[model samples]
Target: MFKHLKSDLPSSIVVFFVALPLCLGIALASGAPLFSGLIAGIVGGIVVGALSGSSLGVSGPAAGLSAIVLVAISSLGGYENLLVAVVLGGVIQLLFGVLKAGIIGYYFPSSVIKGMLTGIGIIIILKQIPHFFGYDADPVGDLAFAQVDGRNTFTEIARVFDGISLGATLIAIIGMAILVLWEAVLGNKGKVFKLVQGPLVAVVLGILYFVFTQDSETWGISKEHLVKVPVPDDFNSFIGQFTFPNFKVIGEPQIWITAFTIALVASLETLLCVEATDKLDPKKRTTPTNRELFAQGAGNIISGMIGGLPVTQVIVRSSANIQSGGQTKMSAIIHGFLLLISVILIPNVLNLIPLSVLAAVLLLVGYKLAKPATFKRMWDLGWKQFLPFIITIVGIVFTDLLIGISLGLAVGIVVILIKNYQNSHFLHIRKEEKTGQEVVKMTLAEEVSFINKGAILKELNKLGDDSFLEIDVRKTRYLDHDIIEILDDFGYKANDKNIDVKIISERGIIENPKDYEMFFNQEKKENLKVTR
Candidate 1:
């Protein structure tokens, strides 16, 4: 892990910059103490990073869980009570890991996964537009279409036009230019460029811009558009920030229910991020999902025991880490330490940095994820793959992350069922036999399930009178019981239609076989196992 120290260190700084505002914004959105988000970010990066098998993934307090946390905090009567649920959620995640449930992530189709990445990219760009112009009404972490501020994702964009800050917009434009120039021209030119990332420079300049223009009436970047880190006045006050869980309410049924909900949601988000991060990784390294679950469980448990919100693998930070050239988990761990140290030491200086500069950094990240080329590539893959991909992006943009993924998965399943129904069997009409009748052959697929029943039955019912029908199972290894019953019924009706039927299988051929069930039963009894 240390082999990539130079790369990981700079990457960690970019991730740190990406993560700082998110920690505060998500905490503000969740109605929890702003310090709690920092704690979760710290625990997620340091604790989870230390334990997780993921090399590129960065864990933190997620924007996705803010609503859940908000409701749970109020419903449970206090933040302390909600912490109990978070701890229990971690335990449940551990149980899930022990059961090897991480395999669930693999079941999602590539189309859905790619859609998720692109959807998030579009969302990032959409959500940050307002902030780019200094309209900071919505929290930076809110990803859902309907926001807590009563204004939705799109309305917020329109709202920004009414409240654009000259100072914020100007600095954002300059910061964006710096980022583009550094990435395209100077990023690889010298070791110094790599050591000091473009984002770090943009943020420093933003702080300086804010400091120098504090007295200006027209060009001043206001405090509302700046990064907000909880500023503790003294060491004793900093210690007072940590809140312990109230385990006294552990007996309540609602607490248990909340625990299960958090566990399920958090695990799912982590698994999905794992998949997305691996795809984004240039190395294409696969993380151990079960171990990731266990690591996340441990992180959440520790985070909740203190004053932290729940933690999960976050794609935004992970993508930042990868895009900035992170090669190992050390980058994540270092970011956590940066969060911890910054809050303890220079939070005042942190609060001086402008949000628009950070927005510029995310804009670049968003463009990388949702580039126009990706859309064309997916479109070229054909409808079978493209439908789900497009649907996932739309759903995510209009709804939330999980809902979009669910919609994509549903479409993918429908496509599979359609394919299965159509490809169950192949029908061939050979030249007429010497008996002056047509010969029809139906070859079953390698595996036929109940889904293929209708197709097989339709073909069987279409047999012409005085025709010779050949049922071929030579390549089939498994046939469903429904299909067997259909073939058995067809065998009994063949005489009425004056159709001659012959069944061919690995087991010897049968001529005009009327007792199809018995023949298959005998085959099963002898352990041939060709038909169900």
Candidate 2:
């Protein structure tokens, strides 16, 4: 760990910069106290990082859950009552880990996953536009098109123009320019600038602008346009920021329902991020899916107890960590500590940083995730790939994350079933057999399911009179009961058509010497026994 500190320290600084605004933003999106988001981020980084087997995966409050959290908090009565559901959600997630439900993540198609990343990217850019222009119509993390303020995504941007803050707009442009310059030029100059990320520089400049331009008549930033971390004047006030769950909600049915929803959604999001992060990892390290569930459950439980939003492995933060050269979980843990220290020691200063600067930071992050090159790449792969990708994106943008993923998965399954229906078996019509009879040979694949029933039945029905039929199952390892029944019934019909039938497989031979049904259902017959 010490040897990797040189790498981890810089990566931690970058991740810290990335995580801060997100923590605040997600909390605001959730309609929970802004401090709750910070606590969730801290716990996600520290507790989950300590418990998880993943070396590079970072956990935190996710934008994907914002809409759900918003609804749950309101439906459950308030934030205090919702905390109970968060804790219960953790218990459910723990059970999921014990039940080995992590494999659910593997069932999602690649196109859907890519679509999710791209969809989220597009949402971030859309939601941040108002903030970048200095209007605070919505919270920083509100990704949904329909916001709590009754303004939709597009309407929020439109509203920004009506009450634009010139000072904030100017600072945001300057911050973005500084960031662009840092990445394009200054970053390549030396290790010092590389260690100091663009976001950090932009934030410092934002703070200076806020302090210096307060007295300016023409260009002055307002309090609403700045970061809004709660300032604790004393130690007691700092402790007061934490809120505990009300266990009385345990008796409520709706509380249980909300708990289950969170557990399912959070587990799914975490598993998906784990898979995506592994793919992004240059070392290709696989995170244990079950352990990840357990770690997330624990993090959520702790976060709920301490007044925080639910936690999940977040791809955005994890990707930032990887891009910043994080080599181990040390970077994640360090970022958590940084969050803790920053909120405690520099809460006032953090509050001074302009909201516009954070918006600019997220704009760059969003662009990387949903680049034009990515769309072109998906399109080049053909309709089978592009359809699911586009459907997922459309669903996510219009509905929500879970709905989008479900739609994409449904499309993917249909594609698979169609391919299976087409390639169920191979039929070759022979001109003559050894006995000089018109013969038809059908070769079964490695595994036969009931899905192949219609295709197989149609081919078997086409045999003409005085024909020989050979059904080959030599490559088959598993045979469905329906298929076996289909073949048995076909034998009786084939015999009436003056067709002679034979079955060949690794299990040896069965012929329609008599009723084929007897051969499979023989009580004590030794003749039809498997050769192996």
Candidate 3:
């Protein structure tokens, strides 16, 4: 993992900066103590990275599961009880790995996966807007459609007008400008520029800004806008901050249910992120899904025991890892240790960073996820692909993450069935070379199912007035009952259109066609049916 030490160091720094705010924000959203987020981050980085086969993927406390964690904690008695569930959840995930359930991640359609990433990106941007404007009523990293504070992304923005802090806004603007300049200009200058990441620079500048404006009461920058790292008076008191899980809760049924929920959701989210990170890898590395699940399970178990929120492979942090030039597991490991050391040794220094500055960093991350080109590319793929993609995007935008994905999956499945139905048979209009006449030929394959009804109807509609149509079933060994009924109905309709119908089969053409049902029954009796 440390094979590329020099190259991995800079990337680790970038991921560290990106993860710091997210860890805190997600913890706040989950209603868990803030330090739990850091614990998860530390465990995810060191434990998960050590066990995982993935090089660039970064695991941490996810905003996606915050809502679930919050509800589970309330229903299951308390945060410590929830920790018992989390530990059990980790065990379940390990079982999932043993059962090889990780393969389920491979079945998601590419369009839907892309849509999910884009949707998450949009949500991140929308959620960060309030923080960018110095609005701290909502948590910095909440992603759910409705926040615990009884406001949503849009409503929060609307409220900003009534409660604007001039100093916070100005500091936010300056922080954003510095971040933009570092990324857009300075970042490309040379080796030195590349060594110093934009996020780290922005954070440093934010602290300096706060220092200069600390005594300026006229600037409107309140204490609320600044970072709020909990400070313990002494070393012994600081050690008391860590919470331990109540082992007695292990016997409860609700704890088991919560455990299963966390395990299932966290594993699924991690698998999806693993797939995404693999796609973004410059070296095009393929991650082993089972190994990733095992790693996540291990990380979660350790995190839960120590009073941390559930950990999972998070795409937001993994993307930052890749974008920042992370090349090995060493980078992820380093970042994890960084989280541990910083919270322990430099809690006071961390407290100086303004929330608005961190918000600016996330705003950029969000913009990159939902770039304009993403929509354009999806549109160019045509309706079959585009419909589900757009539906997923819209659903995610209006609803929440899980619901939007479910809607898209449903639409995508329907489209697949429709296409399979259409392609099940062959419809063609042929011209005889010898006789200069056009003849319509409809050929049913070796087997036909109910899904073929639409194709049959479409071909029937294409017949011209007073034209001869040939329905060939010579190659068909079995035909579905529903399809036979449709043909009978089409026969009746053919007479009205002045179209002459001819049926060709191994049994020959039927004059009255009264025995059509008999032919179907005979095929079924012969045990002739087509498998998918």
Candidate 4:
């Protein structure tokens, strides 16, 4: 992990900027103490990042869980009791990892995964538009369309013009300009430009602008427009920020219910983000899903023990890490340490950075995610892939992350079923050269399942009397029992219809096979039902 310190260190700084505001905003949205989010971010970065097999995935307090956290807090009677649930949830996640439930992540279709990334990208842009123009009504990390501020996504954007802060808007414009300059030209110019990243410059400029223009009537950026990390006056006050869980309510049935809920939701979100992150990885690294779950579980346990929200692998920060050229998990770990040190040593200095500058940074991240080229590429893949991709984006933009992914998965499954029904086998008919008889040859696909039963049956039933039939399974693997039954029944009917049957396979050729089930059973026992 330390081998790429030059790259990882700079990327980690970018992730720190991305994670900082999100940590505080998610905590505020969840109605948890502000410091709890920071703790989760710190633990997520340092602890989970160290343990996880993911090279680039960054975990933290998720906006997806804010609603869940808020309700759990209210229902559990207090934040302390909620922390109990969080700890239990971590245990459950660890159990999930041990059970190898990580395989579930691989089952999600590529179309849906791409859609998720695009949907998140679009959400980031939409959500940050208000902030970019100096309107901070919505919490920084909230991704849902309907907001805690009593306005929907579009309504909030509509209100942005009215609440626009000139200083913030101007600062945001300059920040965006710097980012564009760096991305388009400066970043590739020299090692110096690479070492000193554009985001770091933008943030420093935002701080300097805030410091210099505080007293200027027209140019002043107000407190409401700045990053709001809680500043502790002294050592004891800083330590007091950490809260402990109430163990007394551990036996409560409702507490267990909440714990299970958090574990299930956090685990699902992590798996999905893992899938998306792998897709975005330049090196195409595959994260060990089970290990990732175990790492997240351990992180959550540590976080909850010290007054933090439940943690998950977050896509926004992970994507930012990738876009910023992060090479390893060290970036995530160092970012967490940065969060810890910043809040402890320079909380006041961090508080001086304007929210709009962060918005500019996120705007770039969002664009890379939902690029127009991606849309056209998905469309070119045909309706089977495009439908799910578009639906997922719509669902995410209108609802939330998981809901959008669920909708896309539903559509993707239907597309698969349709494709399977149509592509079960191929049929060819020709006249025998010498005998002048019609010969029908049917070749089964590489894999035949119960879903293909109807299509295969229809083709077999259409075979005419006195015709020669040839069934080919040379390329087939893992034929389902239901499909074997259909072929068996068809063989009997074909014999009665005066159709001469010949079956070909990798094992051997059989003429007019009387017992298809027995033959397949022998093949299954030989472990011949596998793809090479």
Candidate 5:
């Protein structure tokens, strides 16, 4: 992990910026204390990152769970009782891990995963545009299509023109220039620029702008536009932020139900994100899903024992880490330390970094995700692949993450059913050179499911009485029980219809086969099944 310190250190700073605002905003949206989100961020980065098998995934309090958290807190009576639910939820997640339920992460279609990445990229770009100009109607790091303020992703953009801040716009422009120069020109020229990243430089530039223009009326950035980490007045108040869970509600049925709800939702969200993050990793690293669940469960348990939100792998911060060139889990752990040190020692110092610079950093990350070439590539993959991809993108942009993915998966299943209906046979039919008889020949596909039963039946029904028919399954890997039954029943009827039947399969040639029914009906289905 330490081998890529030059790469990881810079990337950690970028993730630190991305995670900071999100931690605060999600806590605000969840109606929890602001510090709870920070605690989750620290625990997610340090605890989850240390135990996870993923090289690039970053975990934290998810915006997807904010609504659930809000309802749980209100119905559970208080924040302390809600903490009890969170701890129990972690135990449930650990059970899920031990049961090896992580295989669900492998079930998502590749088209949907790519669509999710591209859709998130588009959202990041759209969402950051307003922040780039210092329009603060919606809080920083809110990625939903519909915001808590009743404004949507686009309406917020439209309102940007009416209230652009000159200082912020100018700072953003300068920050972008600094980033490009450092990465494209200066960074490549010498070892000096290689050690210090563009984002860190851009942040420093933002701080200088704030300090130099403090009194200027037109050019000065307001306090609202800068990074707003809450500063504690004294050491005792800082110690007071941590809250313990109320164990009095441990035996309540309602508490257990809420615990199950959090575990289920957090597990699903984490699994989906794990799929997406693995795809985005430049090295194409695969994460162990069960290990990830165990790590997240442990993180949540620790976070709940001290005040914090439930934890899950988050896509936005993970994406930023990838774009910024993070190479290992050290980046995530270091970023957590940065969060801890910044809030405790330099909250006032962090307050000077302008929001515009962070927006500039995110803008580049978003563009890489949703480039025009990606849209064109998806279009070229044809309607079967493209429709689900587009639908996922649209649904994600218009609705939310889980809804969009579910829509894409549904469309993907429909496409598979249609393809199965059409692809039952690989055929080559022509008159035999010597024998003047017409021949009907069919080669089965590599895999056949029950969905292809109708198509296969239709083809077999079209065979003529005088024709010689041949069915081949030598190359097929799997033959469904239904298809085997169809062939067996057809062989019996073909004898009376005067059509000659021959089957060529790995089980050896069989003429007028009629014993398949006896196998399935009188004995076990697996007795005759052959797999290589």
Candidate 6:
């Protein structure tokens, strides 16, 4: 992990900048103490990163869980009680790893996963718009369709026009310009450009801009636009910010429910981050899902014990980590330590940086996740893939992340069943055989499920007058009861069409079967069936 120290160091610096505001923002959104978010970020980086099999993925307090955390804290009586749930949640996640439940992440369709990344990208961009304009009524990282602030991404943007801070807006614009220029122009100049990342440069410039603008008599910048790191007077005072969980809450059944909720949601979010991070990795490294679960569980356990919010592998930070050229887990670990040290040593220095500048950085991150070209690429793959992808995108855009994913999964499963139904039949013919013609032989596939009903029904309807239809299931290993009932129903109608249906199996061929289930089950037991 330390082998690429040169490459990883720069990346860690980038991730540190990207993570700072988000850590604070998610904490605020969760209604937990602001310092708790920083604790989660630090532990996520150091503890989870050290243990994680994923070299490039970063973990931290997640925006996705803010709603759950908010509700849990209130319902559980207080933030202290919520910590108990977080600890229990970590234990549950550890059990999930032991049970090998991480494989469930693989069952999600690729299109849906891609859509999720794109959806989150869109959400990030929308959520940051208000912050970029210096409208900070809503927390910086809230992603819900509706927020506790009584507004949403669009409504907040509308409100931005009324409450815009000129100072913060100007700083954000300058920061964004610097970032764009660095990436688009300066970075192409030579090796020097490659050595310094645009975000780092933008952050440095932002700090200088803040310092220069601090003299309101001359530059006219307001203190409200500046970063709001809580500054304690002394070491002892700063240590007072830490809160301990009330262990007495552990006896409550609701606390356990909250714990399970946190565990399930955090695990899901982590799995998603793992998928998105893998896609973003330049080296295309695959993360071990079960190992990641274990790491996250351990991190959450530590975080909760330390009065932090529950931790998860967050895609926003991980994406930033990849974009910044993080090459190994060490980058993640370093960034965590950076969070810990910076907050302790230079809370005032951090406060000098404006929120708008951080917003600019997040804007860039959001754009990369939901590029327009991604939509076109998915469409080119055909409807089977594209439909679910679009559903996921639209669902997430208009609703919440989990709902959109569930809807997309449902659509994807339907598509899969339709495709299987179309392919289930052994033969496709234009016309049935003529009267007394050589028997029209049809075979069935190995495992016939309920989804194959339509195709089988259509094929059976094609038999001609005075024809013999040989329904062969000799190779079929399993036949659904629904299909067997359909066959039985077809037999009664066969006489009207002057057709005879014959079932061929190990029990021997039978004409015009009376009891379809008995015949099928008896033949299934006796026949050396050949699966199609």
Cα lDDT tens digits for candidate 2, 330-366: 9999999999999999998888988888888778777
Total clashing pairs for each candidate: 0, 0, 0, 0, 0, 3
Candidate 4: misplaced stretches above 4 Å? 431-438, 495-498, 505-532
lDDT of 6 at 321: 80
The C-alpha TM-scores of every prediction are 0.98, 0.91, 0.86, 0.93, 0.93, 0.91
Instruction: State the lDDT of candidate 1 residue by residue for 1-532, as single tens digits.
Output: 8999999999999999999999998999999999999999999999999999999999999988898999999999999999999999999999999999999999999999999999999999999999999999988988889976677999999989899999999999999999999999999799999999999999999999999998898999989999988787888899999999999999999999999999999999999999999999999999999999999999999999998999999999999999999999999999999999999989999999999999999999999999999989999999999999999999999999999999999999999999999999999997664667889999999988899999988888777888999888888887777777678778778888988888888776888466566776665564444742
Which residue pairs does candidate 2 place in steric collision?
none
The TM-score of candidate 2 is 0.91
Query: Worst lDDT window (10 residues) for model 2?
Result: 523-532
Where is model 5 poorest over a 10-residue stretch in terms of lDDT? Answer: 519-528
Q: Which candidate do you rate higher for lDDT, 4 or 5?
A: 4
- Between candidates 2 and 5, the one scoring higher on lDDT is 5
Residue 394 of model 2, lDDT score: 85
Tens digits of per-residue lDDT for model 4, 12-67 = 99999999999999999999999999999999999999999999999999999999
Scored by TM-score, the top model is 1
**Where is model 2 more than 4 Å wrong at Cα?**
430-438, 507-515, 518-532
Cα error, candidate 3, residue 528 (Å)? 6.8
Instruction: Give the alpha-carbon lDDT of every model.
Output: 0.93, 0.85, 0.82, 0.93, 0.87, 0.85
Which runs of model 1 end up more than 4 angstroms from their true locations? 523-528
The per-residue C-alpha lDDT of model 1 at residue 5 equals 99
C-alpha RMSD values across all candidates: 1.5, 3.0, 4.3, 2.5, 2.5, 2.9
